[model samples]
Target: MITLTGRLICADAAQAALVQLYLPDHIRLTRAEPGCLSFDVVPTSDPLVWQVNETFTDRAAFDAHQTRTRESRWFKETAHIRREFRIIG
Candidate 1:
């Protein structure tokens, strides 16, 4: 299995709001993906910062998820996010 953890910080409220706006679709689509063991994207007290936690059945699944995500509108929209993330077994 692979677990992905991260913090996503937007530039400001407007950017964060953009994330908030599309969050439902993002979460729903991601969770519905194949081999998605778990997926959560939640807001923090600091509105600009959002927490991310995801798990996949394997590296291949995770890689597939990455590819799909890159092609998503959320990816194009949040291209300016400051991300701090890591993957673990």
Candidate 2:
């Protein structure tokens, strides 16, 4: 299994708005993917920061998720946001 834990840092309301705008679809699509064990993104106390947690059946699953995200509107809109993450497999 592979698990990813992260925080997406949004600099301002604009970035946070982008996240809110796209995150629902992103989460829904990711959770529907084959091999996805669990996926979630939730706002932190800071409001502008979001916590992300994802688990997959294996590295291949994780890689596929990455590929999909890179092609998604969520990634295109929030690409500039800073991410702090750790991966365990």
Runs off by more than 4 Å, candidate 2: none
Task: Report the C-alpha lDDT of model 1 over 1-89, residue by residue, as the tens digit.
Answer: 99999999998889988899887898899899999999999888997999999999999999999999999998898877888899998
Candidate 1 scores a C-alpha RMSD against the true structure in Å of 0.8
For TM-score, the strongest prediction is 2
The C-alpha TM-scores of every prediction are: 0.95, 0.98
The alpha-carbon deviation from the true structure for residue 64 of candidate 1, after best TM-score superposition, in angstroms, is: 0.6
Q: Return the lDDT, model 2, position 7.
A: 99
lDDT per residue (tens digit) for residues 1-89 in model 2: 99999999999999999999999999999999999999989998999999999999999999999999999999999999999999999
lDDT of 2 at 44: 89
